[model samples]
Target: MASNAFRKELYVFERGPEGKPVMAVIRNYTERDFDGLIRIQQESFPPPFPSELWWTKEQLANHVHLFPEGALCVEIDGEPAASITGLVVDFDPSHAEHTWEEITDAGYIRNHKPDGNTLYIVDVSVRPMYRKLGLGKWLMQSMYEVVVQLKLERLLGGGRLPGYHEHADTMTAVQYAEAVLAGELRDPVMSFLLRCGRTPVKLVAGYLEDEDSLNYAMLMEWKNPFIR
Candidate 1:
C-alpha cells in the first residue's frame, strides 16, 4: 500500500456556538503517529476502561507493517483527532461468530489478509473533544471507500451497545439491540453506526471487554452498493 493511500481535507462540523468548523486532514497513519493514537485512546475511553486494552507501540507498528492501508488517522490543526483501523478477512458469513481477540489478534491485527473479501474494522478512536462532530460517519465513509476501492464485498465489524448496560435488567442483549433498531433506544456506538448506514446483522456476546457494553455487540455490515 502507498504511504498515502487516502487523504482528504474534511471540515469539522458542530452546531450551536459550541465551535466552528475546522479544517482537518484524514489519512493513513504512519509509525510516528502511534503515540498520538495512544493519547486518543486515553481520551476516547476513560477510566474503568482498562488502559492496558489500549494500543501499544508494537501493535500500532504491526498494523502499519502488516497492512499500512488499514491504519488511518484524522488530524485537526496537526494533532491526532481520530483514527480507524481495519484489516482484510476472507470472511464466511455463516461463521461470523468470533471474539474481538480472536479476529483482531488482540488489536495487533496479525491476521490481516491482503486478498480477503471483507474489511473487518478492528477499532475506531477519537479524542473526546472531537466526539459528536460527525467524524465517525466520515471515518466509516473512508473505510467504505476502501472496501469499494478494493472491490471487497462488504465492511463488517462489531458495533458496541454502550447504552445497553443501563437497560440490561429490563431486556436481553438481543432485545436491547432490537430496541435500538426500532428507535426505542439510543446507543452511543450503535446509533452512530446506524446513522452512518451500517445495518445490524445480529447480536454477539463476548465480542470485546467493555464495561459499558457488557461484552456484547452487534454484528454490523455495510454492503458495497457500487458492486452490484
Candidate 2:
C-alpha cells in the first residue's frame, strides 16, 4: 500500500462516483521503479510470450539513461499501474515495414537519436485492473507533451492487435486492421490509438513474437498538432 503522506504529496485527487477520492499520479520513470514496472509488465502481458519480451532492469535503466524524458508512468493509489516507453527516431516510411526488433534495435533503443524528428513509442502497458479508466489516454497525452517539448514532427508506434489471434485464421493482418479501422471490429490497442487521433499506416507482420496478436501489429502515427 502507498503511504498516506507519499500519496498526499504525489497523487492528484479527484472525486469518485461514490464521492470518495480517487488518486492518480503520472510521472517519469526512475531507476528505483524497476521492480514495480517489471511487475506491471508481467501482469499486463501474460504467458505464451517469452519473459524475454519484457524489459530487464538493465534495459529499463538504459532507456532512462538514453532518454529520461521519454519514459512515463502512471501510479494509482501510489502503485505503478501503467507506463509508456519511447525513443526519438528520424521518421522513415520504410520503418513501417520493419519488425519490432529492427525498429527498436531489439529493445536496446540504440536507434534513439536526439536530433530525430519523430518520437517513436516503443511500448505502452497498463495493468489489467486499471484498464478502461482513461489512463492510457493520459499516458498518450504525456507523450504528446514530450513531443511538443522536443518539437518533434509526430509520434509513431506499433499498436498491438491483441484481438488478432481470434481472427487470424479468417483474415490477413491487413484485412483485420482495415476492419478495425472501418469500425467493423474493435482491437484493444488500435481502437484506443484511433481514439487518440492516431492513424494506422500499415500492418506489419511479425512485429513481435506475441501469440496473442499473432505476431502482427499496426504501424500507427499521430502527427503533432503543434508542429505546424
Model 2 steric clash pairs: none
Residue 31, candidate 1: C-alpha displacement in angstroms? 1.3
**Candidate 1: 10-residue stretch with minimal lDDT:** 1-10
Q: Residue 38 of candidate 2: its Cα lDDT?
A: 95
- Report the Cα lDDT for candidate 2: 0.81
lDDT value for candidate 1? 0.87
- Give per-residue CA lDDT, model 2, range 1-228, as digits (tens): 111111112333333564334577877878888899999889987885578888899889878888878888888876788898899988777645878787687878977899999899888888887775667887887788788877899999988899988998899888898899799999988999999888978888878877789888888888888777
Question: What is each predicted model's overall lDDT from 0 to 1?
Answer: 0.87, 0.81
> What is candidate 1's CA lDDT for residue 21?
81
Model 1: per-residue Cα lDDT over 165-199, one tens digit each: 99988889989888888999899889989989999
Residue 149 of model 2 has an lDDT of 77
